[model samples]
Target: MDRQTLDMEGARRGEISSASLQMGEDTIAVQCIATMSVESMEFSPWETATNKRAQSLYASFFVINLFFGLMALAWGGLFPGNGSSFIALVIGGVLTLLGFVLGIRAAMMARRMKRRQPYYRLVIGASDGRRIPLVDNNRDVLMRIRDVVRHKMDSGDREIRGDFDLDLDLVNLNLPTEAQKAQTLSRGPDIVPKSRQRETEVEAATAETESEVLFDQDAEIIRDAS
Candidate 1:
């Protein structure tokens, strides 16, 4: 199969070979994969439909109760039927209060439903106990990668290459500490420019000469003591 570049730290300039999965600068051998799974999370279609129906019911209930409450209050106020009128007024007030409460609840539920979004997560477990979790908004892309990995592991393919544009920010992997960062900086550049080759060589030679001089001075001191 064709090799794909993954803008990842471990893969050569984000390039992945068939034998391993590159995560930043670390490689996870395909053969050592013990478990892999993809999970999708979203509001179920049935649940969504049911929610809509319930919202509508609440709205209908609110309107019906509110209308009846107003009518009862109007009858009690206009006709002045004494005891019967008092009971009507009490019932009307209760219905109106209940309607208002239900209306508010339906409004809140609608707002929450509007904000919901689908999420997909892929988790892979290695034999060495490393867990790789990949989360994405797109289900198809996540599933495709999972399928490819499964195929390679089962078929014993030597080459696994694919073009993957994954958001690095979504990955919650361990990051280097300040000490590691300082050590890396002290190590200097891995590849020096050709133009600086002579300067680099001169610097190396000068360092070696200084080390030798220090060694000679130590030896002379030891001889004097003897």
Candidate 2:
């Protein structure tokens, strides 16, 4: 059989393995659905006690705070006047603070999700997609996936090539680079050095481009690495 047929057949028969190595550039915390049973889950050592504890805490806090915030907003709005206004203010303030905290947490979650789902769930004929994780530790993998999924992010590209749908949505898909020369006309000729500024701009522009990865594998995005 030809290579494509072999891959398809292998994927269908559950004998398929990685054909080539790929790096993931970005990730999102998805409600990652795999076929593992609860019976099987009880045995995996990788599901650490710490991770489960943290997830449980995060879930509990999210629900509790959400309930309180909604309750405050609903109950506080019922009253009127300066004294009542004071009560409403407190409720509003609490809710607002909660919202701000949640927003920050959401951002953090997105960041973490990106890291966790470094690769994707491969679904050749949908025996249920297995979580095919990225092999490389390099950050560029996610950068690639972000660019690919930006267009049809919501459906996770369900419409684009069904076989590749999950793979495409699988964040960290690095895009190919362009050969075109970048040409932009600024207001005036060179004045200040602005070396750092220029470099930042270049990085930003490249980040917007197909490849979008400006930093090398060694350049750090997450600073507090232990």
Candidate 3:
């Protein structure tokens, strides 16, 4: 049989295994093989709209606050009457400061959300043109899958015939050293009063027995010499 046919058979039988191997002193590579069907690909319109709406809301609030603050300050400066001028100035200053803080915080949140949002999703396209979702909502993973799909399409391979293997290289496995392992083992259980007493007694008995044996050996040697 041809190699393609063998691979196809393996995929159909779900015979692929996932494993991890140490590639270097600090690097490890994980290999996984799976049979998957790609249905369709599209960007998320809903997510884009939601992001834009949130950004707009924050921007609108900031602009409104800033405009009102400026107006209050202008009124206070243009028309100084009794204590009304002081009140207006204080209100305007507080509002402007609040608006500035809010604007900054909103901008930061929007940027963070944009970074986290996944723009693409993979769907299982059915014969009827219906698409079903697959995989988690992660932009990086989706981008990688998109690249693979594009490559396959560009190569004119329309059909997937066999098991697909994915190799992921990971750095800093963060494994413990031998000394760390020994320390961890040594601290396995706390020494209770009963256990501590038993250990001390065992040590004392062992030392006494050893000393008596040494004394007996010495006496035998002296008798022989005499």
The model with the greatest lDDT is 1
Off by over 4 Å in 1: 1-47, 118-226
lDDT of 2: 0.39
* lDDT per residue (tens digit) for residues 83-148 in model 3: 798999999998888888778866865665544322233333434343333333344543444344
Candidate 2 minimal-lDDT segment of 10 residues: 1-10
Please provide, for model 1 over 187-215, each residue's C-alpha lDDT reduced to its tens digit, 9 standing for 90 to 100.
99898788799888999999999999999
lDDT of 3 at 189: 79
Every model's TM-score: 0.38, 0.26, 0.35
Error of 3 at 194 (Å): 51
Question: How high is the lDDT of residue 85 in model 2?
Answer: 59
The per-model lDDT (C-alpha) reads 0.69, 0.39, 0.50
**Which number leads on TM-score?**
1
